[model samples]
Target: MELNYEGFYRFVRDELNVDLNAYKEKQLKRRIATVMKSSGALTLEDYSELIASDEVIRNKFLDYITINVTEFYRNKDIFTDFEFILRDYLNRQFKNIKIWSAACSIGAEPYSLAMILDKNNIKTNEKIIATDIDDNILKKAKDGVFKDFEIKNLDKKDLDKYFIEKENKYYIKDNIKGMVSFKKHDLVLDKYQKGFHAIICRNVIIYLKSETKDEIYKKFNESLVKGGILFTGATEAIYNPKEFGFKKISTFIYEKI
Candidate 1:
């Protein structure tokens, strides 16, 4: 039998609680097919059974579909510019900043933000919220353990200051680890929390459908306080910021106006 993507989507929605419909159909289908094939499943229905029955297969399926490729200080130049904006602009504007690192894979992005905050001594009312749809990734994030490749972007100074090297792995220091709190959040379906001084959601939204992306941008705008910043990935710039109550302040950065 041919792949039953409609049935698979429903199965994923009802069982996995992930809305596959929100993602670009063609890209998602291609990714699904690739992962499905790796499981030696002839059909999507069989693949779904394997995913449901085997925890390893289930984790693999979720990890693959979510596309969680990330590292500390991803795109060094962009992060450097963002750090400057955080210290010079957002810090000056807000007394106690609230940041949300959406789609944070394995906690690197939020941890990077925490490092920036700690280095600058920026005070926050609460811990920085780092969220992802994948619970398995969230658990790894909470553990704060990383491989060398995952932290290759960090300079020696930051590495020495922020992490403790044990054997072949690096563990995030308690001080920095305390700065961020991890949670499970689905951007496509969950209600966004409001009054954030800055919302950093990068890379993930590019895979979503246009209408879904627009809706998410709207939600992100509403979630931020007036004059807050919304940071996007290098390739995910909003063509028209005004449509989302944003003003293009810099490359890949938007100010909620």
Candidate 2:
């Protein structure tokens, strides 16, 4: 039941609409193998066919590939820069502050933003809209519960202030939960929401083709309020900030101009 390469290519086009040719062969193969094993399928071919024909398997495949493995404050330095930008914007004193945590996995990124804003006393009618393509991860994010290890890297004082221990696991305080909206959004297929003061989409686009990245950035550009910020991963920003209607606000932050 090993996948026939030719048959796999056709399934890619018909089901996922992702041309395997665009992905690095070894990487794609490894991911398929991993999914096959996780799904208890005998072969990649069986897994692929199941995902192609079954709605449940299709969603499960998307969830698996979304690869929502993450923890709170995954990189502290990045959050340092993020805090600076958030404060500067807050200091400018807008009527409203709208932030998007695109591809937010298991609640960390948006919750991080929420914690920052709450701690800073950033005064405004402000909110963070967190979105991800996978419903499973979205549900997890909504739950706002994490293990102790997940928040270990967070600033100690901030951690104490924003989270509480309940039954030996960490849970985001009620304030943080009420400050953000969580939604299921497929950035590869869904329309971008507009007028965001900032978009944090770290490490989410590396798997996508350049054209898809560009298309998403174009949508992001339009969604911003002319001078809004865009945050990508340290290794994830490939498009020139200028051409994307953004100027480099920092090594990992972009400002729409």
Candidate 3:
């Protein structure tokens, strides 16, 4: 039986309340194939039946849709711009330097930001809340583990200062690890963290539709205090900001007004 991928998507939406239609088809299909291959379903209908009827399959679908690739200091330009905003944040905010790493897969981005704060002596008064929809990734993130290659882009001093090299891998050290708190959060259903100093939600939105991107951006804007910075990945940005109460801070940066 040939599975109707279109029908499967509709079932996922109406039954699960998860919008598979929001994702880019090419990417979505690629991920779906991984599950299908694992299930060894020769026909599309068989795969659709498996996906629609099994709760485990439903969770797997969410995992595939939300999991994404990341590296430390991904896109140097974004970090460079973010650093300037961090300095500004330090100057103005004395307490509750709350930051939310929405969709902080495996914790690289949040750990990287933690290293930056520790280096600048801003970690003392600051707090970072890292969230992901997937519990599997969140557990790894909470452990603060990383392979050596994950930190390859770092300079020698930074690598030495922030990471402990052991057993052929590197782990973010206590200084940075203590700076973050990880939790399970779904961007679609959860309320925003209020009055944060910054929100680094990079790369994850490319999987979402423009409407979702705008919806999340609006939440981010409302979550931030005046002058709070919102960082996005290169080639990923909110399609509009007036609706979100944010102003373009730079090419890939925005600040709440």
Evaluate all candidate structures by whole-model CA lDDT and list the values in order. Answer: 0.94, 0.78, 0.79
User: For model 2, how does the per-residue alpha-carbon lDDT over 1-257 read when each residue is reduced to its tens digit?
Assistant: 46686687678667765445544456667787777687778866787778877888777777766668677766788878878887976447455778899989898889988887887777546568898877788888888999977887886787788888788898888888999899878776668878888888987677776777887888888999977888888687645877888888777888888
Clashing residue pairs in candidate 3 are 2-45, 3-44, 3-45
Q: Candidate 2, residue 166: CA error in Å? A: 2.9
Ranking by TM-score: 1, 2, 3
Cα deviation at 208, candidate 3, in Å, is 1.0
- Candidate 1 per-residue C-alpha lDDT over 199-255 given as tens digits, one digit per residue, 9 for 90 to 100: 999999999999999999999999999999999998899999999999998889899
Worst lDDT 10-window in candidate 3: 87-96
Best by TM-score: 1
TM-score of every prediction relative to native: 0.97, 0.86, 0.85
As a TM-score, model 2 comes out at 0.86
Write one digit per residue (lDDT tens) for candidate 3, span 198-234.
Answer: 8898888888777777777888888988878888889
Clashing pairs in 1: none
Off by over 4 Å in 1: 1-3
lDDT of model 3, residue 206? 80
Local error of candidate 3 at 166, Å? 1.7
